[model samples]
Target: MTAPVRTRSSEDLIRAEEPVLAHNYHPLPVVVSRAEGVWVEDVEGRRYLDLLAGYSALNFGHRHPALIAAAHEQLDRLTLTSRAFHNDRLAEFAERLAGLVGLDMVLPMNTGAEAVESGIKVARKWAYDVKGVPADRATIVVAAENFHGRTTTIVGFSTDETARAGFGPFAPGFRIVPYNDLAALEAAVDETTAAVLIEPIQGEAGVIIPDEGYLTGVRELTRRTGCLFVADEIQSGLGRTGRTLAVDHESVVPDVLLLGKALGGGIVPVSAVVANRDVLGVLGPGEHGSTFGGNPLAAAVGTAVVDLLETGEFQRRAAELGAVLRDGLTGLVGKGVVGFRSRGLWAGVDVDPALGTGREVSARLMGEGVLVKDTHGSTIRLAPPLTITEDELLNALATLGRVLERSV
Candidate 1:
């Protein structure tokens, strides 16, 4: 008979990972054994309110019933049938997903980085084939301080030294421009430009929400310059920002949309590059493909996520609760928070440096039964699950307040 697995405490489990696990991440010290909705229970049976929500990947919360039901039903039937063969669930997923984003076509992939890479390839192809750019001369304009992905090519353009250092030599034909600066963007784009890619809200750069009209200005500039505008809505889309996409706040639509994070309903790694036919049609069948893209399981779960978004309940909750979040942060401005930037349920709070570094503050919050992550030096980001009740949010805020008070 197989030996029964030994149950371990949170500290024991954490210590066990140090030897075998890669040190690529410095996650908070919490061994979550079970989770439901907005709460997670550690191995020791202590519960904590999940405030970071998997960097917005768990926007619908842990083990969402509808999403889980879809996953279970699909698992019983089929899972992966590589792009070599058609999956029965792919058609509806593509149709509904494209419809949800007001796009004409979908090229499914797994992970946000894949979607960004795929979008880049499609844009370059369009530039050479349609825009008449010379071969190997296609250039993409991207904003500085961007966090598209960790892939070599993506990091090559990143302004963050931590993500870019020791990862080169990077591919060429890319231009870096200051974010939210239309004048600088206009100067950067020219005939060789394939696309201007940017995140609607810079999530990893501490939820940096651009000034009003920034997105619209990007759309207009791209249209005039004849370059495609690719919005990386991977972290800001699918009801996290109180809308289908963060670009919706300005009623602007880009030529290509890169989506991920919550698209899989927190069950799978699902991502896609969505675009109109003319832009996406540039790619031939033999040019690009992913083996597991649009598999049956991912399609089913993605379709269920789209169905939930169609009802707009999550978006409404994000918007209404966003006001509550904003007000709470406002109250904390002078208390412990020096400043903050917020959109919907997403926020980057800058706490007083005298209190402690962001990581230190996060550790303190963990002791108070709350979980959040730090972005930069003194900035901690908050992106709680949309399913969280008003009382839960208030309680989390109160917990933060108590932690800050004790620190002082």
Candidate 2:
């Protein structure tokens, strides 16, 4: 007879993985075994509020009923057919997602990195075919300190040394410009430029928000320069922000929108390149494809996610609760937090360095039964699930305040 699986303690499980697992990530010492809306439990049954929300991948919270139901239903019906044959669910998913983002077509992919890579390829092709850039001379301009993905091409243009240090002999045909600076972006673009790729809010750069009108300026500039404006909203889109997209705050639309993260609804890996036909039409079939990109499983879950967004409830919640978040952070400023940048439900907090490093604060928060992640040196990011209640948000904020108070 087959033996039943043995349960392991958190420490025991963590220790066991020391040898087998790669050390690419330095996660906080918490072992989450299961999760529900806004909360997760470790093996020992200790529950903590999930403040980071899987880096915005779980914007609907863990195991959302709709997303889960969609996945279960699709699993029984069909999972993948490998793009060789069409699936019933793909058309609905593509159509709904395009409508959600005000786009013409959708190129489904599997991960954030794949979406970024796909956007780059589409832009270059559009440049060559439509813009008539010389062969092999299509240049793309990117902002410094951008974090599109970890792919080789994406990292090649990254200003962060940690991501770029050992990953070179990097890709060329890319130019670097300062983010949130219109003059710098204008100087970088020329006849060879195909697209100007940027993250609406630089999530990995400590949630840096640009000044007002920056996105509008980019839209105007790209239009005038005859270059596609590709907005990488992998971390900022899908109702995590107050609107359907961060660009919506400015009422500006880019030629291409790269979306992922919460596009999967925390159930499966799903991503897409969304663009109008004029920009995305440069590619013929077989120029780019993924075996599992538009599979039935992803399509079902993604369609459900769109259904949720179309209700506009999550976006409204984020906007209303975002004020609470902003108020809480503002109160903490000069107490334990030095400063912060926030939009909707997303925030990057800079705690007083004298108290501790961001990692230290995160570990302390973990001890206090809250989960958050630290980035850079002294910055910690908070992007809780949209399903989080006001009381739960208050409790988490109070817990942060308490941790800072105790440390002080």
If scored against the real structure, what TM-score would every candidate get?
0.98, 0.98
- In terms of lDDT, the poorest run of 10 residues in model 2 is 1-10
Model 1 scores a TM of: 0.98
Off by over 4 Å in 2: 1-6
Q: List, residue by residue over 267-325, the lDDT tens digit for candidate 2.
A: 88999999999988888989999998999999999999999999999999999999999
CA-only RMSD, every prediction: 2.5, 2.4
The global Cα lDDT (0 to 1) of model 2 is 0.94
Query: What is the lDDT for 180 in model 1?
Result: 90
The C-alpha stretches of model 1 lying farther than 4 A from their native spots are 1-6
Residue range 275-352, candidate 1, lDDT tens digits: 999999998988999988999999999999999999999999999999999999998988899999999999999999
